[model samples]
Target chain A: MRLSLGPLLYQWSRDAIEAFYAERMADPVDVVYLGETVCAKRRSLATDDWLALGRELAGAGKQVVISTLALVQAGSELATVRRLCRNGEFLVEANDMGAVRLLADAGLPFVGGASLNLYNVAALRLLRGRGMVRWVPPLELSRDDLGDLLGEARRAGIVLETELFAFGRVPLACSARCFTARHVGRPKDRCEIVCEDYPEGLPMASQEGEPLFTLNGVQTQSGAVQHLLGHGGALAELGVEILRLSPQPAHMGEIIGRYRAALDGACAETAVDRWVTAPLCDGFFRGAPGMAAAPDP
Target chain B: MKLVCPAGNLPMLKAAVGAGADAVYLGFRDDTNARHFAGLNFSDGSARRAVAHAHERGCEVYVAINTYPRPAGWRRWQRAVDTAADLGVDALILADLGVLDYAARRHPGVRLHLSVQGSATNSEALRFYADAFGVERAVLPRVLSMAQVERLCEDSPVELEVFGFGSLCVMVEGRCLLSAWTTGESPNTEGACSPARAVRWVESAGGTEVRLNDVLIDRFAPGENAGYPVVCKGRFTVNGATYHALEEPTSLNTLELLPALARAGVAAVKIEGRQRSVAYVDKVVRVWREALDTCRRSPEAYTPRSEWMATLASLSEGAQTTLGAYDRPWQ
Candidate 1:
């Protein structure tokens, strides 16, 4: 199976982001998703910069996909998405229906991002008709749910690629309010760029002191990283065309390397766990709570 | 502007219609709708009665089959659309693209309103729904500021509806997975969030603790008001301080924005509580209906009455309310 790097959900310094991508130019990942999927206020990389980066990655033989904002509320945001859809050089990931409409109207083939919430074969078929080439199901779907959907799609003669969010902190929700700013007692409009400080997002814990969620601007992600290195074989068996590993602050290259090695049969699938420092979970894969971890196979 | 109120059952439907609701929205008893709560929503017989009752009062009935249909249960959602259309409801409030496609093709005469769970926040998205499925009205998710809403009202190809009063959802509807991440059930798949069967409330010496699937969502101190243990509204610790990191336990009350909404030519205002009691449906719908009437009579002279505001406040979640994302500062 091919390995892909998901979009960066956290806000980092421009230099840090550029340097991160520079390092990924030689990483084992075959595909890379570029652009901001969270708050529009995050301008670490402007639209031109993202396009430049995509070209650099594309030149290096890695497939590049431009990811759009998951929540499109403002006219300016919609305009930005329109520009991204018209970026002729690379495929765009439509996170919301606005982007989907723009890309579909242009007859540009795109990836249906996880936030599109495709839960059934019929939804998949509709997007396919709209020129969607690949789809990332919402993070909450189980392996069985996906298997059933894909099975139905096959029976219905629908053809499209499937990408699974196999690793990193699972995005749990997105809101208009910037939780990162709110945590520091600042309004979303007048707030300083507080999200830049937390490269992996500000960690939040429950009342009883258990790690719960990661507050990254307007998005809330699971505090524990979702590790699916152990499911490479299962994913391939289920006809998963791509495995998406989200970017983290550190050890991303190493994580990508381990996934490559595991997929290549050079190492055991569970060996990648050594590179993931945070607690790991794969509950959604087993049809259980996402925070619950299934025992390693 | 039209006032669309939620009704989980027949009594709530009658209550909303009696309270001057222009339309009443409800769901089937099964998982086809977003408010698929036990002992809530209507069975086929009750749904028929609800439509007849609201029709008698000159109120429209909209059936919400808003939840995304699972592939295994896709037939159920299609059945719901056919049943609602068969019952002669005014419209079908839908979110799933597959279901919308089915409804538009099979029930050409029935109107289609895009549910808030559809997550269409821009004119382009609205246009896509209108062009593809003939959606007549699109409910905006509670994520846009007032300026954005006004811009949409001017640009949208279809009619626009905004949430007026309800328990607020901090996350964008249909996209949020926080509840599923914790409970393995979600509104998109199962039509429930923090499903009641997984909830546990324990009174302890320190306080009253509410847990979702044994995860401590929030703890209320003695005499502190306790709200439902929704994952978003729960208190959590960030850095070293404990606070409502996402949002507090509150409701969205847009009474003060009635004049502005009316001036913007908003097609309708929706009150969102299909899971609430019949009394809540009556009181909240009455307050919004009066506010809408006053605003329509004189947009320049309209002001929310203190009595209406007080009644809404008392009925709000946690007995408190805010303008939500409509006000710039709230974001």
Candidate 2:
């Protein structure tokens, strides 16, 4: 199994993002997704900068995929997605239907991102007809559910390269309203780049002070980190071709190293829970509630 | 614009038709639809009868097969589509591309209306559906502003239906997984959000505690009206203060924006409450019908009456309503 670094969902400064990717050039990850997947107002990296970065990453012998926005509302946002799709050098991860349609029309091979909501084999077949070569299943899907969908796909004689979201906080929702600006009492249009303050995301807790979710601009993520370090063997058995690691502000290199070791057969399959200090969850894998962490394997 | 009302059962369907609904949309009594609440929706016989009743009253009946079908459960949804077509329903409101493809190919004469769960927030996505499945109308997700909706109407290849009044979904539909993360089921996959079977209510020293699958969603103070335990509407702590960090318990009321929507040339106005009671549907649909008739008759003198607003507010969630997403500053 190969490790692919997923797109950055948090708001980081341009310098921070550039430096982060530059350091990852020598990392063990084989594929890297680049570009902003959240708010469009975040201009840390413009269209030209992303294209440049994609080329630079390609030059460093990494498979690069340009990711599009999760929510496309305005004409400008759709235009940005078109430009990204027409860049014509690297593969595009179609996060929304608009991106998918544009890529399909252009006859370019694309990766169906998790938010595309391809739940069944028929939807997978339709996208495959439209030139989708790979797909990332949504975070809420269980191992059994995915197995069923892939089984159906195989029965229909379609083979799609599957990637699993293996690590970091799973994104729960995205909205037109920027919760970060709303929490700070500013409208989304006039909010002054306040998301840059939280490198990861602002933590949200329940009334009794239990950590519940993370508020990241327009997106809400899980409070518990998804450490799937031990599930490497199961994922391979399920025909998962790649494991995606979402970028965090700190300890990503260590996280990548552990996943690399696990995939290389150096670490045991059930020894991943000890690698992270945060509360870990693999409930979606077990087909139970997604927040319920599977008991140590 | 036409008034599209929601009905969960035969009586609710009759109530909507009698209350001046131009059309009534409903789902089957299974997970094939999004409002898959217990003891709700219709059996095949009841659905056929409801269609007959609505057709007798010059009202249209649209069946919603809006949930995403798992591979193991695909046949159930296909059966639903075939059954709805056999019943001669007016349109099929659907989301899954595969289901749409099936309906378009197998039942060639059935009109297809893209459900909000499809999440076609832009014109390109609408065009994709239109060209691929010959979808006749597309329901816009509740995430667009009025200005954006107008622009989309201008560019759209098919007719557009906008949500007129309903419980507000803060996140984009078909994309949110907060419910499944906590309850092991989702609206997209399981056709229910925070399914009632997983909910538990308990009286504590502080107040009523609402739990979903044993997870504490919120605690209501003794006098603080307890709303449904939707994960997004619950109060939570951010930094140090406790408040509705995502969204408060409220409903989306667009009565005041009827004039603006009419000017935008919206083909239909949808009122979203299949889970509500017949009495709620009867009163709400009557008010919207009168308001729509008056507005279409005299656009210059159109204004939402205080009594109409008052009646809707009484039936709204949390006894509060806002022009959600229609008003620019709310976002």
Candidate 3:
């Protein structure tokens, strides 16, 4: 399966973001989606800069896609949806229906983001009819659930590529209010870019002091980074064309290289065997509680 | 217009109708709806009685089968939906896609309103639901401004009902799992937010602090107003500093914005106090009813009285109110 770098879900400086993507372009990623998928108040990178970066990445032979916010809170957000859909040279990943409607109205092909909750096969076929070129299943979906959807899509003669969230900190859900910022004593309006403080997001603790969720702006993520390194075989069996590696700040390059090595059949099974105790999880894919990391397969 | 109000129990159902609410929205005593607090909601008998009482008043009753339907509680939620349909309620407010599809197919004539927990923020998401399941109306999330709601109403073919007054949800419905993160009960499946079980009221040296799941959210001096325990509205430490990270516990009091919300194409204005006393529901509903009636009569001449504002503020946590995301200049 080809690798696609999902949009960065936190706020980082434009220079940091640009430098990250500039380095990532030469890496093994085939498709790169750039833009903020979490909170919109983050202004480190404007749409123009994102587009310029997309062009630069495209010049380097990576297929580029632009992502809209998970929660479109206004007309200006809708206007951003319009711009993303109408913008040439980049495919749009429709996170909310605003983006989907704009792209559908423009009669342009797009990607169905995980936030849109495309669960059933009928929903998948409906999204496909609405100019959806590929679909990223919602984060909580299991293999059986996806198998059911894939079966339905295949039976209906729908041609669609599926991408799996193969790595990085899992985005559990998105919200309109900024939890990370609010946790830092900031309103969403004056968020002060607190999400930039924790590249992987600030950690949340349970009452008993267990590390629970990572508070990333308005997005709440899994405390455990999702390690799906050896699961590539299962994804290939499931007919998933692309594996999504979400962006994190530290060890991203090494993480990408490991996944690349895993994909190229260069890594031993023992390398991924230790994945169980890695402090992250992949239980959602295994149909268990999202926080429960299963024994190594 | 349907006056949908919260009913924490059967008595609340009676109280809601008595207070001019045309309908009472509630759930079973399970993780089925947004207010799945212990000792709240109904048993099978109460559900039947609630439906019977509302039907007798010539008003409607809806089952808020609105939570995300967690994996552990899916069967209970499924059973709740089945029982609600069998009890013959006028409509069911739903959030989960699987539940909606099941409700649509199983009970063809029962009206289904998309619960705010579905979080259909944009027309495409709304249209996706409308075309798929034939949703009649949608409870709008509290994130939209009046102008933005008007823009949304243009494409929202279904009836759009906005929350007029109550405890404000800072997060978009369905999209929020913070409660689950802290307490393991989400609106999606567990049907509660920062639940009472996780909340603790403790007297500390700094102040009287309200903690939700070990997170110290708010600390007030003795005799100061104490807001309910919720994570987003509490005080916390981050980056070696302390602050009110999310929102302070200020229950939503939009008594002044009824007319603007009506003009913004809101089909129905909702009052949010299901957990409140019958007396509180009576007071707030009567005042809001007067305001809504006045606005409906002239569409003008509605002015904010300081006393009215003060009374509402006195009832609020820390005596504060924000137009919320409605007034906030959203990016």
Order of all candidates by DockQ, from best down to worst? 1, 2, 3
Q: Write the per-residue lDDT of candidate 3 for residues A1-297, one digit (tens) a residue.
A: 798999998788888898898788789999999887777778798888899989999999999999888888666776776787788878999888667777887789999988766656545666787789898987776777677678767888989999988887777766566777666556667777877888667876443344556778877687677776656788888889999988877667777777888788887541432433237666667765566665845
Shift in Å, residue B272, candidate 1:
1.2
lDDT of 2 by residue, B1-331 (tens): 9999999999999999999999999999999999999999999999989999999999999999999998789999999999999999999999998899899999999999999999999988999999899999999988899999999989999999999998999999999999998898999988999999999999988789998888788888898888889999998888897889999999999998898888988999999999999999999999999999999999889999999999999999999998877777888
Q: Can you list the residue pairs that collide in candidate 2?
A: none
- CAPRI quality level assigned to candidate 2 from its DockQ score: high
Which lDDT tens digits does candidate 1 get at residues B1-331? 9999999888889999999999999999988988889999999999999999999889999999999987889999989999999999999999999999999999899999999999999998899899999999999999999999999999999999999999899889988899999999999989999899999999999889999999999989999999878999998999989988898889999999988887887999999999999999999988888788888878899889999989999998888999999998888
**Candidate 2 C-alpha lDDT tens digits along A1-297:** 899999999999999999899889889999999998998999999989988998888888899999999999899999999999999799999999889999999999999999998888889999999999999997888888898988778888998899999998899998888899999999988989899999989988877776778999999999888877666777888889999999987778877888898788887543444555457888888898788887742
Global lDDT scores for all candidate models: 0.91, 0.91, 0.75
Model 2: C-alpha RMSD to truth? 1.2
Greater lDDT among 1 and 3 belongs to 1
lDDT of 3: 0.75
- DockQ for each candidate? 0.86, 0.81, 0.27
TM-score of chain B of each: 0.99, 0.99, 0.92
Root-mean-square deviation of each candidate, in angstroms? 1.0, 1.2, 4.8
Cα deviation at A247, candidate 1, in Å, is 0.4
Model 3, total clashes: 14
